[model samples]
Target: MKFLKSGLEALDEVTVIALGSNMAGGYPSSEALLEAALARFPGARLPVLARSGWWRSAAWPDPGEPEYRNGVALVETSLRPRAVLEALFSIERGFGRTRGAANAPRTLDLDLIACGREVIDAPGLVLPHPRAHERLFVMGPLAEIAPGWVHPTLGRSAAELVVTATVGADAIPI
Candidate 1:
């Protein structure tokens, strides 16, 4: 592993994180909330290297819900896999996300899409995001920043995955 200037073993791992928001609840607009949430990454020890423009898409499983603003960010961090996951959760909570139903609309959503070439299948965290390849919202924004990024588990590039995404046809660049 690489070491940072502070002598800490830098996680040195590049991670792709998917950002989404629908209902703002008490926050600003969904897109604004997403942007603000991303802004916190750098302060949380996750420095963003690149990010995609916002994309709009209908909420999954429940199209009746408000459309979601989606984007993807490439970040570098020195934290462990689980620590990274926890950080994401913390960010979500900071934005007023609540744990209720699966795929439910919320103020913010952060998904850890991938981390370097690591493949993790732990209980609470899964690397390369289990459903990333199938979600157009995720793949479209991910392709914008890292088209050549390969999914460790699927062995396919983000661009390729976007071409075959079955559910994201409604995703449009905003």
Candidate 2:
């Protein structure tokens, strides 16, 4: 996903990320992850309230394990999308996350490049998260932070997409 550097340009930009942990050594709890992120991005202004806690969703490419505790985070950062994603990977590794397989459960899972002001399709990332419009975990938290934020490509709001997306309501707060 692409991000605008200036606050003026990013005013309307929205970013969403999926949070989950169920891999080896187990994933750090949402609260812990949030705390870590804040510490790393000291001066960064986060979304008013990142929607998180717990949820159950179909395990992607990989299945048959415990359901994931999922949510989303809204953040305003000056770092480019790729740079931000690299930071997320570093955090995951610090939390004992290992790349066992694609879609495998992880101790700390962070998928960046959720959505932004511009449509970007890059080697390591894709704008709008490819499925942000179809997943509630990503959209739910995004809505909490940027309800009016419009999708650069679809021209839809986070809340609207999440409400219309197909997802199980069994995802409850921890």
Candidate 3:
């Protein structure tokens, strides 16, 4: 495993990973689950280069549900886009995530927000996650770590998009 060069926005190795957990499952808290989850990425070959602090945000489509703990990680990986996605899903399952009703609370939710500057749209994988820019939970932490990151399709930096994000408007750093 080699480093992806120094500094935040350099190197083509950069990729964005969104982390969310509303249910701790066996962990003590959602925050704890998220922290432990980040630690697992390196073993998956996606070493975390930079990470934002955990954020608290109301659950979407239903605010009455337990709030979600969210954050973003910038990692450097040589894996292709699809492989990167597969690794993320595998990591989620290891933390007890299950596929059920859409948006159901879960022990862990790992999303591949972007793969370098790759703009991909295909079955089972979507780069720069279709709705990620519209969600504060994603954009907020992204802004904290890589404020200048421009979406492949949206054409705006995280710092710029976070202002107008339509979902999770109540999101705030914990």
Candidate 4:
């Protein structure tokens, strides 16, 4: 675990996070919701160091749902991986997201795509987000902010993975 001198000791790794939203009912526009969610990170204890421009893409595995607005952020924090995940969940809830059917439309989605070079496989949290490298939605935004970041397990850089991603070909700048 690398520690930054931000007055915190034994801090966990810096992480890249992916944010997306497709549901707009009962809330602001999906794009606005994403922007608000990113803005709230600092208040939630996860300070964003860098961010990518929002991208619009069709819903994964189910195009019947509303289109999604996606983006990625680089955050530096002292919180552990699980703690960071919990915070993300809280942020989602704050944006009116509710747990439901798998891959169902959501108001907000926040995924911790990578944490430095750490590879964790705990019960609930998986470091480097098991499928990040294979998903265009994740890799596209990630490449924009940290193109040189290498996958801890795959030995591939974000830029490399983005080139090979089979999905997200339809993603467009928002």
Give the worst 10-residue stretch by lDDT in candidate 4. Answer: 1-10
Off by over 4 Å in 1: 1-13
Every model's TM-score: 0.90, 0.72, 0.93, 0.89
lDDT of 3 by residue, 1-174 (tens): 122236545723488999999999999999999889988999999989889888999998898999999999988899999999999999999998888999999999999999988988899998879999999999999888778778888788889999999899999998
Score each candidate by Cα lDDT. Answer: 0.83, 0.60, 0.88, 0.81
Model 3: lDDT to the true structure: 0.88
The lDDT-based order of candidates, best leading, equals 3, 1, 4, 2
Candidate 3 wrongly placed segments (more than 4 Å): 1-13
What is the clash tally of candidate 1? 1
Candidate 4, residues 1-174, lDDT tens digits: the string is: 111233212113458889999987565688888888988999988998778888999987899889999988878888888888999999999988899888889999999987777889999899979887887888888777667777888988788999888776788766
Q: What's the lDDT for residue 41 in model 4?
A: 97
Candidate 2 residue lDDT tens string, 106-142: 6667776354575778797787677667767666655
Residue 131, model 1: Cα distance from true site in angstroms: 0.6
**TM-score top scorer:** 3
Q: Can you write out model 1's per-residue Cα lDDT over 1-174, one digit (the tens) per residue?
A: 111222112222568889999987666688888888988998888898778899999888889999999988878888887888889999999988888999988999999888887888989888868888999999998777677777787878788999999886899888
Best of the candidates, lDDT: 3
Which is better, 2 or 3, measured by TM-score?
3
Give the higher-TM-score candidate: 2 or 4.
4
lDDT of residue 69 for candidate 3: 95
Estimate the Cα RMSD of every predicted model relative to the unseen true structure: 5.4, 5.3, 2.9, 4.9
